[model samples]
Target: MTARPTKGGALYALPNALWLTFFFLAPLLIIVAYSFMKKGLYGGVENEFSLRAYALLANAGIVKVAFRTLLVALAATALTILIALPVGYNMARSKNQTLKLFLVIVPFWTNFLIRIYAWIAILGNEGTINGFLRSVGLISDPIHLMYNQGAVILVLVYMYLPYAVLPLFSTMDKFDFILLDAARDLGAGKLESIVKVMLPNVRSGLVTAVLFTFIPIFGAYAVPLLVGGKDGYMLGNVIADQVMKVRDWPFASSISMVVTFVSTIGVLLFLARQKRPGVSKEQAAALAAEAAVAAGGGR
Candidate 1:
């Protein structure tokens, strides 16, 4: 039977509802409200309602930063997914899934800023990579590895890889490996068998991973700030600069709205694809549902 919320359930849900209201929904509504208000001469938003903040999005410089943010986010997300897919598949099939998952999650035990700085130690110009190369007499000058778009993307991938892996592993764990053998018997190539048979079944995990990695990277700030140097400007930095440096709170709120909107849409997309617990999708139905998405085009 379908369960319905009882009148008494409000008592049980009150604390969580109150928590979301204060911590999440309240701030989100404030940002939405501020996005349409006038920017104050000093810092905060003015009482006067205006669309100037949204209008500022057309500024050529901000547009360029947005474009760069999109590119970097896409590159980082793609790399994370590519690396995570194999690792997830291996873990899903591993004899020691717990150990592999534990190792994947160990990074989270450290403070995020410390982890970023740790990368700096490894990738900085005079850091570990260069020191090792110089010790081996590989070169005279230190190789420039830090403070670029590449570094930002690389670090982003490293940071978000586990998010992709966990979701992919969760979905792939349910996948029927026997489907691959059947595809092989039908004369499918190895890559074809995996891509056509395996990936189609794991669409939920792939979508989850993509959204999880892409959204966070799109709004990345510290990775770009510490490692991106002059070229790694992104929308998150723009929002920070507007609020802290430029003192344009309205503009910052508007950009925050954009990020929030994108995140909401991603969540909706995930909800649309999520399979109900204890229910399974037929392979043909799954392929049909995801054809326009995963397959992209014909062979």
Candidate 2:
């Protein structure tokens, strides 16, 4: 027999369902609809339906911008993952809970914009490092620290490190270190043991971390806007400029829709990868029953 959810549980789900339907689902539908419509002469979506907006996406100039943004986003994600993996592993294994918690949350306490602005202040031509170097007879002139690709990437990494860490750390909490010890005892070296035992066990966490860092980095605007020069700008900045500066709402919506589609595909791919081999609920139930009988837990 199928078990029914309690009334309280049903009520609890109702609010979330309604919230998603209105806020998430509805806006996505609007963007999708806008993508198919024609751009009006007066900087709005025309009433007529057309594929011009999507067709415009294939234009060489626009495609170049999109491609550049994708490259930057992917690079930023890779860096975030590389940094987060080791930090998360350390945090997960550390004995000091207070230190771990402080490291995890302290960056998040500061306003996100303020944090980006702080990077600007540090990375500007008159920034701290350059000034210190100049004072110590290291450089005669201040270096251009801000408004470059490196600065943009630095800001992106700093902004999203906490996001990547949370997923990785949470997954690390579920790590089975016994497997590593067994591998080592069976003649595996330290690196080999980590690769064969630890990595496989924490694959889901790695996937989660990649997704958490990737999606937000792909959509990020603030850091890029602050530190990014014209060449350093990402798709999100382009979208913002189109919508607010250029007033090309339809084109902006189209870009947003494309990003949403790409992000959805990424999430679906991650879910597919996480699916276990030859396992289903029915199989699990049968196995559980067999185990119960073997252990004398069955009634």
Candidate 3:
């Protein structure tokens, strides 16, 4: 027979349930409703229903901004993964766990805006790097270091590095390094061993990292606003402009709904991938045995 939840359990869950319903579900419902409404003459939404806001998405400018946002988010996610893998691996394998934790935790002590501002100072034309260069006679004029696409991507990668690394480190922490030695003994080179053994084991963590990094970067506003000038503006900037400057709440809501839908689909796909059945221990052992046999034959 199935056991029923206790009164205490119900009581404990009540607050969390209320919080989600009031905060998340309520806001989401409002946004969805607003997306279908008309934009008021001054600001906010109107009582009339219309699809014009969604139709606006077909505009070439809006499409281009959406495309650019996706491109930058993908680029940032890929770069974060590339850098985070080694850092996560080292953290997981390190004997000095204190140092590893310190490295991860220290960055969080600073405010996120402060860190972005720090990047601004470092990347601006009259900023630290350019100032130092000019002082040392490296160039006659300050280099255009800030307000560019590259600077935006660089800052995004830095901001999201911890997100990628933490999930990877969590997964790698449970990994068996002995598998690598076994693969090596079976004549697999370093890269082959990693590809064939390590990656398969930690695929879930990698997916989680990618999702976390990609979703936030996709919706990023301030980073692009400060560092990304006209050339580097993203969908988030467009949404912000619509809401604050143009006061086009309906159009902004429609854009937000599109973002939410796309992000949800991406998340669902990752979850589906994670839920797929993987190879059993016996099959893995068989593969290892075959590799050993092949190695022996080559010898």
Candidate 4:
């Protein structure tokens, strides 16, 4: 017989709920408050409320920054998918799953700032890559590679790759190999089977990878701050500059609100696409039971 949820189980969600309320919900309300406040003459917020800061963001500079941020984020997500999908698929299909997973996590074990700074050493004008290129007589002058759009994009891709890979690997791991074999048995070619059977199996993974890579990249500050030049500056940079440099709290808060709203919409869209119809028998029974509980509670 199925055991009823004990007191522990019933109360288990309370701690998490409290934590979310204290942290996430509370901060969100603060941001909303700040977004509606007036910018002070010296800095910070005034006692009065205004949308002047948000209206300022409607200018071309902010629009350009937002556009560039979206473009770069999309590029990073696409590159991560192209690289991670095959790598994750290989890892999932491998017998040495532990070794492959270890390889993936090894880089993650170290500090993120250290890893990002390592890229600075590699991509800098007088850095190892330029020295190596000079040694190989590839070019006379040291290439101006660091602190460009390319550098920022590269760093963003590297930073978010593992995030993409892990979800893709998890989704691919449960895939039924026999499905592809069955497709082939029905006279499908290798490529055909991969297209028809394999791609569909990993739809959830693709959605997950896109969301993980894109959303974080959009808000990423460290990568751009370290490696992005003027053109490479993104919305995060603007948000940061407004808060710290200009000390325009309301304006910064408004921009942040926009970012949060856009990100939430994107995540919801990604998840909506992943929702599959035709639930399994077990899932259907669970849903039915939950509905029954709700119905009884309504009485």
Candidate 5:
């Protein structure tokens, strides 16, 4: 039998629907419209429709910057994953829940800009490290650490590591440790058990972590601007310059649209991959049961 629709549920969803329409969808539509328009003689977009802005994206310099941005984002995501895996695992398996929560929450208490500025102080030529070294007569001159690609990547990894860890820890928390025992009983080594049993279970978290880390890093402006000099200038930096300095609104809008489109496509591909056949309902149920047993044992 078909169930009747509930007016109450619709009422509950009204506020959220209105919020999205006003805040997200409306602004997004405006950006899309602007992307198609021509740039004014001085600044801002004109009403005249044109594809010139998008055409500009095909320029060799712009293409190179885009590719460089992608490469740096990929590298940062890889490093974040490598560092986050062990941290998340320890957080998930550790008996001291209070410490784990403290570690996660303390970083959030500090302002993000302050954290970035702190890095600048540590990395700058006349900053803490160089000052200490000079005081100790360790070096005649300061090392060139700030305003480089390596510094940009380092800061990015630091910024996004928590994003990766939280998702991974959430998935790992519900994990069935008994599955590892089962795999070992079936003649699998520790590494083989983790690869064959553990990772597959947390695939969703890993994908979420990758998306969270990659998208933000791709669109990052402040980090690159502050730490990234000529060698580290990304597409985001170019877009920011076009809008703020060059006053080329149309080109900036087009670049923004391209980034949004590419990010959407990447997310869609990841979602599609998740739907493919592998993990079965029975396996899932068994894992749940194992987790329940483990929880009871802990209690």
Candidate 6:
């Protein structure tokens, strides 16, 4: 007799369901509601409906900031993936995988703010690089390094590299290295084998890494504030300014809504791509089961 599937899986999923409802959905709903509401004269929002917040999105300053944010997010995410792919591959193939992974995660042990300040100390006009250069008489003056878009990008890459690496490593660890050999036997070059065989296999990891790195970077506040200075004002900074500096609650909410919408759409598109043609339903189900087990162990 064919075994009937039980409803036990739904019971096991209850905690996560409730957690998303309360933590994610509820807050998203609040933001959406606020986005549609009118802004108050002081600090709060009014009950009446208004499109003024979204209309403000057309402002030249906000649009410029949004464009700048997009460029930074793309550049940072691209560099992160490029760096992380090789790192993840090396870690996956390393004899001491556990030690390497520990090293990758060690940065998380410190407070994030402390790390940003550390970068400031290292990159300031009179900081370590300048000190070393001056000592060698390379230049009479210190090069301007900190408080620019370059510094912001550098710190962002440093901050999110691990986020990209972890997911890529996790996926690569499960990949079959034999497929690469097979491709090589078929006369594929090393680069071709990796691009044609490995990347397609680790696409899930790429999706996860990009999502983790790009979304957060797009909405980043502190790094841009601390390292970017005037030119570093991104959409995140705009949202903060609208809420705190301008007391424009609705405007902030609207910008937040845009971010949330873009993020959601990106997620949906990527998730849809996870399914490929020619993969049987049974295989899909098996992959899902494996992912669930892996996620459980990760938790």
List per-prediction Cα lDDT, in the order shown: 0.82, 0.76, 0.82, 0.79, 0.81, 0.83
Q: Per-residue CA lDDT of candidate 3, range 1-299, in tens?
A: 55686778888789999999999999989989988999988898889989989999999999998999999999999999999999989999999867886777576557778888999998888889999999999998888988888999999998878777776776787899999999999999999998899999988777767877788889888899989988888998998899999999889999999888888987786757655566343443343333223212210
- Please identify which of the two predictions, 4 or 5, would achieve the higher lDDT against the true structure: 5
User: Which is superior by lDDT, 3 or 4?
Assistant: 3
Collision pairs in model 3: none
Best by lDDT: 6
- lDDT pick, better of 3 and 5: 3
Weakest ten-residue segment in model 2 by summed lDDT: 290-299
- Give the CA lDDT, 0 to 100, for residue 96 in model 3: 89
Judged by TM-score relative to the true structure, which candidate is superior, 2 or 5? 5
Q: Please, what are the lDDT tens digits per residue for candidate 1 over residues 1-299?
A: 55597888889889999999999999988989999999887778789989999999889998899889989988999999999999999999998999987787766667678888999999988789999999999988998998788889888988887777777887788888999999999999999999999998888778868877787788888889889876888898899988899999889998998887877887777666765553344532443333223312110
lDDT for 144 in candidate 1 is 91
**TM-score of every candidate:** 0.88, 0.85, 0.88, 0.85, 0.86, 0.85
Question: How do the residues 52-117 of candidate 4 rate in per-residue lDDT, one tens digit apiece?
Answer: 878988989899999989889988889989998889889989999999977886676556777788
User: Model 1's lDDT to the true fold?
Assistant: 0.82
**lDDT of candidate 6 over 1-299, digit per residue (tens):** 56568989788889999999999999878888888888887878899988988998999988999899999999999999999999999999899999998887776656678788899989998789988899999989899998888899999988888777877887788899999999999999999999999999888777778877788888899999999998888888889988889998889999998887878887786667666653444543444444333322211
| Preferred candidate (TM-score higher): 5 or 6 | 5
* Pairwise TM-score winner, candidates 1 and 5: 1
Stretches of candidate 3 off by over 4 Å are: 1-3, 274-299
Ranking by lDDT: 6, 3, 1, 5, 4, 2
Residue pairs in candidate 5 whose N, alpha carbon or C atoms collide under 3 angstroms: none
lDDT of 6 at 209: 80
